[model samples]
Target: MIIIYYKNRFISISESESSTLNSINIEFNKIHDINIEIYKFLANNNIKNLHLFGKNPEKILKKLKKSFNYVKAAGGVVVNENNEILFIKRRGKWDLPKGKKDKGESIQITAIREVSEECGIDPEFILLKNYIDSTWHIYDESTEFILKRTYWYTMKYVGNEELVPQADEDITQAKWFNLHKLEKPLNKTFLNIQYIIELFISQCK
Candidate 1:
């Protein structure tokens, strides 16, 4: 049993301990009978560990019938010559730079662009040797939805430019931290982000 909470309410779900639901579609007719708010309905019924989609309940039902899909892509993880990783402070949380991929851009270019836009340093050197795994979580700025995928790449900085955080993007500051001093904060990062760093370190060994 897992309880999904959204908008201050919980939805209870029971499944075989070893079974997981990857995606679920709740029709408006069925959802209207659940006695929960629309957002909570979607949140509670989402396929565990899979993408959740929430919009106007009626519209979502329509899209479900057609199998409409939603996906967003981003890139991140920046490192420097001193074996330090660059991080940004945003919304009072430490984070790596990442943003949506532009049309016509390759994922690698998206990685470089996001790093440069957020940190103001062009990578002088880069290697595309590994790919960090994917993660899913609800995004509810306007309507609840999921960020389907965020692609991560380990990058080495080669530029001589000074660092600048993209202020308008809500990034307050940017700086590099030596790995030895990064344990605590890195542990607090999203699990997938932490996994990427750990994988990179293990590969170096």
Candidate 2:
């Protein structure tokens, strides 16, 4: 299942009906201009939830991808020996270390490189643990809409390298927050980032 967040609302793409009430269900493939329809739905403040369900959700997702400029990104949710989570401040919002996939670069490598470059950690010291999950979101850029799918991985930071935020990326701070005291950063993070951390915590339990 995929839940794309926009303006604090959500569009769920799955094989079954969403549990959310007041959801605007859509047979998105039949719509000639999926992108325009999505924009209209998003613009309507009354419509808080949107569901696109089908037997083959992958096909529906593929169809949706064709309607916009698609991008792939990968990132890490890194944990240190002190049981703290690594986070970065990007453009004043708390965000995990992530970036777009380079040409011909594997997603796993992209995750490692992004964490290394963004958080000033050595790629060798960032040990990839397991796949976490992926998230989808849409944003408008100039005249085109961009659909980004970010793959996430769980990682462990074994070294005590002095943290440095990537200034070129507008990351002002790179710090680790105690696992139990995450309220400060989580409150300032994007919905997708919160979802990733929640999903990761659920898996850990």
TM-score of each: 0.64, 0.90
lDDT per residue, candidate 2, 1-205, as tens digits? 8788774677788887776888977775566777777778767878888888878888878877887799999999999999999999987789899999999999999999999999988898999999999998877779877889999999999999999899998999999999889999999988899999999999889
Q: Give me the runs in candidate 2 sitting further than 4 Å from their true place.
A: 29-32
Residue 161 lDDT, candidate 1, scale 0-100 = 76
Candidate 1 versus truth, CA RMSD in Å, comes to 7.4
Candidate 1 has a TM-score of 0.64
Model 1, 130-181: lDDT tens digits are 6764433234556444434467777777766788999999988888889668
* Residue 152 shift from truth in candidate 1, angstroms: 0.6
* Best candidate, TM-score: 2
For model 1, give the 10-residue run with minimal summed lDDT. 9-18
Count of residue pairs whose backbone atoms collide, per candidate:
1, 0
lDDT of 1: 0.59
